[model samples]
Target chain A: MTNTENAPSGAEIRLEEVTKRYSGTASPAVASVTMTIPPGKTVIFVGPSGCGKTTTMKMINRLIEPTSGRISIDDRDVLDIDPDKLRRTIGYAIQQAGLFPHMTVAQNIGMVPSLLRWNKKKLAERVEEMLDLVGLDSAVFHDRYPRQLSGGQQQRVGVARALAADPPVLLMDEPFGAVDPITRGNLQDELMRLQSELHKTIVFVTHDFDEAVKLGDRIAVLGEQSKILQYDTPEAILQNPADDTVAGFVGAGASLKQLTLLRVRDVELKQEAITARPDETVEAVRRQLEERNRPFALVLDERDRPARWVHKRQLAQASSLRTAGKPIGDFVSTQSTLQDALEACLAEGGAAVVTKERGRYAGTIDIDTVMATVQRLRDEAGVSE
Target chain B: MNQFFEFVGQRWGSLLFDLYQHGSLVLQCTVLAVVIGVGIGIAVYSSPGGSAIATALTSAILTIPSFALFGLFIPVLGLGVQPAVITLTLYALLPIVRNTIVGLANIDPAVTGAARGIGMHRLGVLTRIELRLAWPSILAGTRVSVQMLMGIAAIAAFAKGPGLGGSIFSGLAAIGSKTAVDRALAGTIGIVVLALVVDGLLVLLGRFTTSPGVRARA
Candidate 1:
């Protein structure tokens, strides 16, 4: 991952003392912002409305010229390059897709490549390839105009158009802000999948903290005048906000949101629970539970999968382990999110059974373990509860 | 009516010639007006002050009575096609210029921004994106101009310009003479019939030229 500094697919962007002062304005629009965006990472700029988050992202591609600052990409000064030529090399996508109404989907996607004077045959191939990459069927969508498509479909075309030329850097300004929540989630997932393979240096701007956490590899929480409150991984930001403003932006369910970021596999499972075959006599299970000094024991079936939970008191009414205690109601796999684990743990009202491949009894995650895991994350982030 | 029909049959050759000239005059003037109007629109659409001035000037020309316009042009330019072309083209400019300005101004800035974001230069955005999207409005303006010009070109004949207006004026001058009413009715009917045909052709042109995405809305 350290070699990502010179990743072939994307180029690093650096902004140094970038400030934009609109004439007659008392304060600069973006006042002295400096940050280095690593190559091949989706770095998000999240902030409240009119906080200059969008203005910062736009400056990267020179859409809004920085009044006085040096901005460089891959160590080459962006201001040195011709603005239009530089823009052609940087992919840009915005909300509502902004596709040309007169052009078909293929035309919109092919515009930049065609501008670069790619030959007709190659340009045509690239358009089809781009459409396919964005999960659009060329046969159906290639000839269709932007208005003919649905909102989500239009956004897909917008993304496809931006990526058509395979620019090393992509600047997205709230690209998913206009879509319905459900479609927006699907689009975010699709973008994540695309980024995994493409690895373009993406500078995304959004006011939605949840969206930033969901999509960004590193989220830069911006404040007034494009101030960088916290520029770190989502995990770090959620667990430990930089200050009161950032914490307020993170909102009340910060730890709850943190749970969604973690998975069951990442945490230690409680594997020392006493277990017995369901066919064994309930007297032996009760004796084993007493020997282990535990209030309950898990009963495993023939193939060693979890079958039931036998309480110390329930063993008196049952003659055999087969008829002992109560059936295991719900369980989570090792791949489940900690949030899902917590839900399952709460539903079962005790230690939640953790399963591995094919529902085999793996271990357990009790309520205390779930609480402690979140506490451990907070501790690691140097943030107190 | 029977006398008008008999007169048309007798003067069919001359009437057809008048119709052709009337059509030619309207077509030429409309094309000229569109060229100038769209140019002014493109130049001024981005500037509120310029657009307002251009629109006001074109509209002022429209308020001038047609006969008075002909009289004003006659002293400097005299009669015939020169006055007719200038007068007719001037009168047609209001709709074309206004529509062009409105159409160009109405284009979504986001669309133009996206165009520039994708590497289109200033002229590229103007010709390829802004103009194309605003074309529907521009074309509608042209349609209105053409309709207005069809009637206005008849007035141009008062300055001794070519077209059916000459015949209508002659019929009025020769009132109570045999076939005078027939001649006047012939000129009136010919202009109406020819205006419809030209408008239909313009409609067909719109169908062919306009993008389906825009056409769907219209």
Candidate 2:
């Protein structure tokens, strides 16, 4: 029943002069690649197939023996230790889940712990905890076999199993590649949520740059022969790619992708929004709107939350703010990203989107404000786009 | 048909004894074959050449005439159940060994890689994951071996091995006699019945021993 809250933080992973060349092959699969992965961060290796990204990852856990070069975790050489023993200290998840069809969900998750000879009771508790951690109910899923679960569920169990022992490092290779697009997006979000709590050092490999940009704390965009073209934060990489090679991988929606990284709360809110109580007389609201030279004023309920928007022309015909102008349906939350804010504005067909904090009216963000903020930040960083 | 019933009624005691002995001989030989075959399969399953050689050798043994194989064993093991059981065990090896190898080899490499990546030693992965996943195919091999050897065990009566095969050869030796067809009919019927019963038991065994996950697939 030891709390993971007190567990040791993730350890640093370092690869120095790492290279792998299969026998009988003229060129090395991965050539002289070296990178330092900061502790408790997720670094993704993204490139096209045959770029040796997977081979490079396999060398970290020694699944594939390195031809030459040094790989060290937390400053200890991986080759210096017994591979099996070293593997027990690291978590590894792969595509297709690779769950043992002969084992129950609980048994699969408890495998490493059981190998370490954990007592049955302790193992059971850990299995339940892992199932919960992955958002699966232990009561319903513990005894079910892999075939009994859906593909997405099976992958969740795979992740739970990898994290069962709470290993400091987790290596995942296309973990969501087999699922449908919607399910893949959900799993990606789930992994992000889990990483916020566990903070394990993760090396995720995928051919999809969008996924890398979404999940990676830092992304290593690799080119042919596993050569790393650029390694930097997702925003930095998008705003300032190392060269045309990296930019090609980043693809056409570079600015739009960058907008996804910025949250609605990241920009300054326009506090100049005119507002009136629901019971306020139309003449008073019209006077206030006129004073501000604004066309519309938000009608607020008793709790200071938006009821509706009242237009200056409607105020002339209406007695109170209660039944004036048009009702706004799309309200963006403070936690929503700038993309969400822009989408909300477009969906509502309004010039600006209202922001809500804890169900109360916070402020508003116009589409122009979002674009201006993004452009200003890009210029400040001296990025061309 | 009446003559067959008459022969059975008169030799009812010995006939039951013959059936029991037939069951024992087939069981013993099949069990021995399973152990040796599965052992060899596991030992060489990892190597392509070794697996090919082992499967080919066992399969070659099956192509040999049963009568000749029994006779060949006579000079070394002599008559009675020894030569008979040995011959049956040899006949049983091909299916068991082939299936065991195929079963182990067919397991998804991703599954084994995951097992190894999760820190299972080679032996642990083989025993706990690979073998368990391969169990259904291995059991199928065992079933084929058991049924095949049951008939082969009847042929073992050429060396005077235990079982109803003795009755069959004896009836054939008396050729054209009234009781000849009766005895042969009884022996043939006995062999078929025994095969059916053994097969039914194996189906039950597969159900009971196979994991629910593997069974769900079938």
Candidate 3:
């Protein structure tokens, strides 16, 4: 909702007047393009073939030298640095995994680490850990050659290989493109999960719009010759396109697309002080309760964070003193994404209470907030009842 | 029976000695030709836009008539194995150069892109990824060149180059005798055997260098 320029400063990667012109070509493949990618975020470049999205991403890691302009990583000019040494610190993944045909999966994933000369024991452990991180069984894959794996499996190996050395920056160019649609989706989700945990600054190139929306913390929509038409969060790009090019690129239902981008935090949550604590028994809770008719009471830990909810029906099953002092951090955090919050609700097998770290209660979001946000987004998009 | 046994006893030692000497010369021709041709072939192949030059040079050298090229070289190098070896090496470059380019170009772009993206410099990418991926095709080219050179090297013996060609020239010098025809036939068989053996060896080298997974797919 706020201008990105005015947003808090972060570790940024910037490209200024970047251009790539192949020999014998009339024009530069990538024109004067300038953009920034914040640290610990996923930025995807999406466009049709020949649009220069791939070229732009390649320039970040010096895979393709630009004809002009400067590219910087973490505020340092990339040209001043040695390309190979610079690339060693950046994670890169491509379609089909490109695991070394001669190397086994383990060796492929261990490439960067091995190059960095990490001790053998650490390298072995990291390789196995990466394999497991990408959901591959190290035992099954560590010794297996790249050819033995299927397209999807090869891509999983690719991701693990890219992240092997845990570089601060990652460059991925359609890393899942070779796989079938179903597998691609799974890999996308896996990437999202990985990004959440690893928080590496990532530049992803793809031709798929849905993928950009699903994975990108920000999406840079480019036109012919790799000109950026708009670079913004999915919601902003969808709901408030910068120009006709961006509007057309966002396609139909751009309005409702904004709603999908909003999380539960965007909607109001029910907040009240009338809640019980982990140490409070049902009888004592009832005695101290502000309203006896309350159908559900929030449970809190010592830090006053919302924990699990206790329904009146469950009160009869609980002993007076036994239920007291049970820490409720197992309950999900309030700041979780809507989908995660919904999952937590389902996991609780009843109403889910939102809590913060240190057991502070942040209030609960019910089906109402979820449905309202969904309906509001639908209405804004002009969807019929 | 007495004449045949006497003939065998009389020529057997010389025949074995000639076979060993000529056999080594043929092997020498094949190896030298491949080395020279492949050396020039890689240069031409690696040239940004010099394929036409390689083609022209090879085709023109091939057109001079194998004997004529040797004849032209004799005045300078003097009648020996030098001219013959040089001609065979020239002839071998076309196939080797053409195939090397094809192999390098046909390497999956994705693999090369991945190599670069993974932090490999130009040399690293070339040696580790491109060369390895293109190994089979390059070796295929080498095989074609070696087989062709083996046959050509035998013909080189006409210009005083060693090989079974010596026997053929000797046989032709005594054309009126039926024995001459028999000797020529034996020489021809030897040349064919040399070609087959070299070809087999090149194919084996290609197989050894080729990645097992790529071979299985092929």
lDDT of 2 by residue, A83-157 (tens): 999998899999999999999999999998988888999998999999999999878999999989998999999
lDDT per residue for candidate 1 within B11-106, as digits (tens), equals 999999999999999999999999999999999999999999999999999999998999899999988899999998999999999999999988
Report lDDT (CA) for all predictions: 0.90, 0.89, 0.74
Worst 10 residues of 1 chain B by lDDT: B209-218
lDDT of model 1 at position A170: 97
User: How accurate locally is residue A287 in candidate 2, as Cα lDDT from 0 to 100?
Assistant: 86
| Candidate maximizing TM-score | 2
- Model 3, A155-211: lDDT tens per residue? 998998888887878889889888899999789889988887777788999988878
Q: Which candidate achieves the best DockQ against the true structure?
A: 2
Shift of residue A295 alpha carbon in model 2, Å: 3.8
Q: What shift in Å separates residue A185 of candidate 1 from its native position after superposition? A: 1.3
**How do all the candidates rank in terms of DockQ, highest first?**
2, 1, 3
Error of 2 at A301 (Å): 6.7
Ranking by lDDT: 1, 2, 3
For model 2, give the interface RMSD: 0.6
DockQ of each: 0.65, 0.80, 0.42
